[model samples]
Target: MPSKKIVKTSNAKKSQKQTKRDLKKRNKKITIKKDNFLKEKFLSSTANLLIKAVSIAANAAIVNREVGKRLNRRGKEALTIVSQLAVDVRNDVKQGVRAAKKIQAKKNGLKNSSKTRVRRLSA
Candidate 1:
């Protein structure tokens, strides 16, 4: 009689488990890399947005400062003009009062002289 062959049976369940573990490990690595990339992208975008906002704010501040300076200059000019007009009006009023007083004095002197001359002629 021939000698019987001793055969070892491969364990199918154990092989399946190892393959599943390897697939899970590869998926985990891919997921970690993807998460890292997304985080980096988000950080970069946020930094860019912050930079733009700061620049815009700085520009606005400069513009506002310039506008304020212009308004200040205009306010000063308006004040000067108004003060000059007030001074001119005061001078005009003073001159008019002086002229009126001179005219009234002359008219009173002329009336008294005419009455005296008429009384002398009649006497």
Candidate 2:
């Protein structure tokens, strides 16, 4: 006798649909959280950098060549961080657009592959 595997075939598709729906909803929340995280990260970095610059200025050593070089390096690093953040956000938006288009295509149906013409308005 051969052992048979049990499978819930009908609910399999339904569960997949439910998972996609849940994923869509969860994605929105996750995006907001990501934005918040990036915002907080950038703001904190900017604040700390500002404080460091202010301290350097208060010490009246801003005129020193070494101090100027340090500030320049810090500024360049900050710019690099911000640029990378922008790239990440832009990539996320592009991914979202691609997902939206895929979903739209699925919703439009596979009538092109069907032998029979799909009736419009169910007339």
Candidate 3:
């Protein structure tokens, strides 16, 4: 009687297939986790950017309003100064004209007196 040894090859093949399935499952789970993490990060970052943009815009608007108010006040002050200068110039011109008229009248009186003396001497 000869004793024969039987090798179980099917069991080895089954184990290999099981290991391959497990590896595929682990890789799928890892990819899914990475994708979810990326999505969450992107969404949070975008939300933060939007919030910052809105805040900056609000601050800019407030600054613009303040600057506009200041410019308006300064413009009014400048306009007042210009108007006052114009009035001053008009007053100065009037005074100059009056002085010139007085001087001309004196000159005319002197000429008239001289002419009367000349006529008296000739007569």
Q: Give the TM-score of each candidate.
A: 0.68, 0.39, 0.72
Angstrom error at residue 71, model 3: 0.9
Give RMSD (Å) of candidate 1 vs. truth.
Answer: 5.7
Clashes found in each candidate (C-alpha, N, C closer than 3 A):
0, 0, 0
Which lDDT tens digits does candidate 3 get at residues 1-123?
A: 797888768988999999999999999999999999999999999999999999999999999999999999999999999999999999999999998998888898888888999999999
Off by over 4 Å in 1: 1-16, 111-123
lDDT of 2 at 1: 90
Clashing pairs in 3: none
Which residue pairs show backbone clashes in model 1? none
**Winner on TM-score (1 vs 2):** 1
**Which 10-residue span in candidate 1 carries the lowest summed lDDT?**
7-16
116, model 1: CA deviation in Å?
Answer: 5.9
- Estimate, for each residue in 3-121, the C-alpha lDDT of model 2 and write its tens digit: 89887678889999999999999999999999999999999999999999999887776458677898899999999999999999999999999999998887665655342354443
Candidates' C-alpha lDDT:
0.95, 0.87, 0.95
Cα distance off (Å), candidate 2, residue 75: 0.8
